[model samples]
Target: MIQLKHVLVLVFLCVFSGISQSTNGYELWMPYSNIEDSSLTKKYRDYSKSIYFPGSTETLMIAKNELHTGLRKMLGLASIPTNSNRLENTMIIGTKENLNSDIQQSLSKAYVEIGNEGFIIKTVSIKSKTVLVVTANTDIGILYGVYRLLNLMQQHKNLHNINAVDTPKIKLRMLNHWDNLDRTVERGYAGFSLWNWQKLPEFIDQRYIDYARANASVGINAVSLTNVNANALILTPMYLEKVEALARVFRPYGIKIYLTARFSAPIEIGNLETADPLDPKVQQWWVHKADEIYKLIPDFGGFLVKANSEGQPGPQNYGRNHVDGANMLAKALLPHKGNVIWRAFVYSEHDADDRAKQAYSEFVPYDGKFMENVLVQTKNGAIDFQPREPFHPMFGAMPKTPLMMEFQITQEYLGFSTHLVFLPKLFEEVLDADTFRKEENSTVAKVIDGSLHNQKLTGMAGVANIGTDLNWTGHPFAQANWYGFGRLAWDPYLSSETIADEWLRMTFSNDESFLEPMTRMLIKSRETVVNYMNPLGLHHIFDTGHHYGPGPWVSELSRPEWNPTYYHKADSQGIGFDRTPSGSNATEQYAKPLQELWNDPQTIPEEYLLWFHHLPWDYKLKNGATLWDGIALKYQQGVDEVAGMITTWSIMKPFVSKEQHEEVTMLLEIQLKEAKWWRDACLLYFQTFSKKDVPDGVSKPLYSLEYYKSLKFPFAPGIRPQWD
Candidate 1:
């Protein structure tokens, strides 16, 4: 949010003097480069003449060290620690209790407002000296405040009269890593797993510490290290030792470690025949396991169990319900103040209901039945993470239960890491969606932050895309997805535009020329992806197995919902799933207003037209295009949008490092090529049923429908069967 004139100066300094050392994105966003604005540099230097950080705890010391590093790099000053206690031109960093009595009394109301994990970074006038203060209620908050203060400095914000006090709306902002022990990641576009299991416990990689730094910078307080497709061996003593090592590294950054508990671990590792929730031995084993984990790592977060879903073992194996399973674990962790995050991403081959409605039907009746420590984690959409989807119906339905949102930070369904899709745009849209739970404007953010439901526990979990790649995430811009996820998890209501602006300023360039167009491009990237891949509410049309390309014709999987044809019921007569009263009636799961609005195909948004109802091939769209033509045009528009991105990037090449520009240019080329692949492949396949041409505005198919159908990838990055 820097003014235009200052922005121009920053850009000029960056372009001419090479102030931005954006060589490879290995630094993530904490580059700590010299300030691009000369005026701001002097002002920051004046404030950083000396620091008064008065604490010996690890978190506090980390904040003190960060100040040294930031000041040294950005302002070219040592700003070494001094015990003189001279208030003049000093940067004070401490908890509220550690601050001077006079200042503490004046800031008591601010301290109370920020709660435990919030912090204040302000320039205060005390005893005729201009001193900047960074104070919080807890050590972790001090660390967070220091990170925030550095970030503002990184973005070249004027801190002269700054008064910023912020807190996380959600309690547990976390990254759920789907990483395995063997070094493969599920749905991971990034090269390989970050955890080197063979070298752990003894060999502590610097990457782990940097990962914690990155997460802590954005206010992510918790992490689940293992895949939800759980492995019981991870809970064993050997792996627990490894987990303990990771826990130690993350501890200083205020991140609690969570492991996925395989539902049948009692049988798999505990030498018990059954993992039945009601059984005495099974319950005892889990209690003992929790105790053992806590003994190793005192602040260990509880399990993230993905049970009774996707072939994973659960309480249903023993004819027990989810409550019985969740409560048993909850009881074990309750004494330790740990939480059991039970994923509600369940669908069954046994149930004869729509896949989208099954989670709601199964979990809604059991609302308020779960133990206090148990949190039901639900995905953003009812279905798997598609490019675009209507908000899941379960967010408002399970009112009595504490529901945490689950969003995919990886690009599993959106052309992988190759496409520069800014996912915060997608996250923002979902957060702003009104559920009409209690009344109008009851947004998904309210439900997640406990403003609407007044729930005790609230969280937002993002499936991590991190790996051993040099840039952290595979594509450089993919870093923004991880960055945006944390920012949104910290404050769900923050706009994607604001996130794009901040990320650009910190990671790439703060200049107005570079920031303005890129911000717009980043904000539009997700929709561009949506338009190309799954335009007009098409869901899960990914091909069989790898899902690397278009697969709308895919069918004949053993499970009915596993096939793309199941989602998009394209036929000679019509297309789209029938979720209205006459069909699945999934709309009935939503609130009354939504149900009313969604029942009719004509009234629903065209983007979601196919999701709620089946429509005729010739149904007239609002733009006067037929249904088939509209779909074709949207696919074409998506391709054109990516082309526009290329053009925009090409123009801004002078603003970025040559290596970065070239790397992204190559990736965007792949994205455009694939966009055409999606456009042509799907359109050609759907045209068989539509019995019409692709329409005037839409581009012609580059390849035949048969060619697209015949293509197969045997070794996509995140594939199935072996999964490794």
Candidate 2:
């Protein structure tokens, strides 16, 4: 066995290696850089000298360890614990149950405010002695409190007389991993899957623990381990043992493990004849499966199901509807206190009508029919995840159902992980959208948080951007999107700008010179991608299969809904699919006021102009430019914004490490190239129908339209793995 001294040397070498290449981002906003300000350092170190963090429970142990690590790295304070009976000048951290009886009695009122998961940190006089108390109702809450305490210091906030109480607004803050069993993640641009199935059960990776720390830092309570396009083999006993190992690792961080259940598992794995919900054998198989999983992992969250979407099998494969399919699984997991997140991303064989309207038309009639444990998971937009989409009409319409918001954290349509697109601004936009369901200010945020219709179960799931990349997310700035998603999931009302500021301070530096322009660029990055890729309400114009770049002229595909030309319908007459009464009548699915507002082109928001109506090339925009000229200018503007980003990052070299600055500088160059590619490719294709010259301010296409069309990428990352 290795001696204790040998262990110390090995650990020091590993940490030093990570520290030496600090700009590699392996630490991910937790580098714990030393305080440059002497006053702040002294103040932080003075309070942290005598930490009375008691209790040896797993969660409490991790909290103590994190406190030690943070203090040592941030303030060079190696000796953190002061095991003493006295409370004066000590920072006491524990669950309310473990605290002194007198102190617990005095803090009963504060405990009531924290509920089960919330925590409180207060500096108060105990027996005429000053002590800082960090207490919560449960051990998990204490762990969360400990992370919050460290994060405050990381953000360069002075911790004098700090009194803070926080509780998550959304009950189930979750990540829906699109990872597969074979380690090929669908739409995963960072790297392959994190779960090493070949070496699981006994060999737990340190990345698992670090992943939990990052999630707990921002209060993410749940994660679905497998892909939504799930595999039935995961339900087998061999896989449950591996899953149990992961659950044990995550339990200390207050996270529960969730799995994605394939809809046809009964037939696929159970040797059953059918997977019909009404079949007794199929229902019994699911019940037994849930019981088996629960026995292995008692605190398993539940299953996320993708039924009847994208050629994936579902209850619709039988004659049954979504309600029939979801209720069956919900009943099975009800005894275990687990949930069933039924996806509302479905389409039918009737591809002639609008694909965006199929899900709403199919499920809206069965409102309030689902079991209490069942939540209808809907994506942010009606169509697939686009650069900028209007809030799905399904929200607020199903008043009695618990609708969980599903936002894609992965930059699937926003230029993958290559572009630095901050997604919290996109999430905030959808949350703040007015649904006009009952009265004024019936925002989508209120609907999901249970305040609007008073729902009992609420959740927000982000399609994870995580992978095995060194920084977790592919781009260093892409990590902000993941961080922002968690923060927004914790509190739907948080401003994207505030999230940007905190992320910047923690990830890089606290200097205002770096923070101000960086924050501005981060917030505007989403719109910049939107302008270059799919400007003015255009959606789903990406190329076939890989969806890497533009394919607005793609009309030869077998399925109408699969082709970009189906949505745009560009011709000599006009462009854009008219969703108003004159065409597909898709706008009528929304509430009365939104229906009235979106029907007319003039009354609609200009950003979503082409989403609802088509117009002639000569049509004038509110900016006093022709429709053709406006489209050309918007595309040009997007390319210019990317150039500006490159310039902004060029000057940021002084603030960040050379490696850090150069990495982003290189990515910015790639982003600028792609932005120009999007602009040129789209304008050239659309120009075919408009029969017009490139507008004045827009740059001339470097290649002919045929050359742009000829470009092909057979090996783009993030494509779904093809199976025999």
Give each model's whole-structure lDDT.
0.90, 0.89
The parts of candidate 2 lying over 4 Å away from their true place are: 1-21, 100-106, 127-130, 721-724
By lDDT, who's the top model here? 1
| Pairs that clash in candidate 1 | none
Model 2: how far is 447 from its true place, Å? Answer: 1.1
Q: Write the per-residue lDDT of candidate 2 for residues 523-637, one digit (tens) a residue.
A: 9999999999988888899998888989898888777888999888899987888999998999999999998999989889988989898888889899899899999999999
Error of 2 at 248 (Å): 1.1
TM-score of 1: 0.97
Best by TM-score: 1
Number of backbone collisions per candidate, in order?
0, 0
Candidate 1, residues 490-543, lDDT tens digits: the string is 999999999999998888778899999999999999999999999899889998
What's model 1's overall lDDT? 0.90
* Model 1 residue 7 distance off true place after TM-score fit, in angstroms: 30
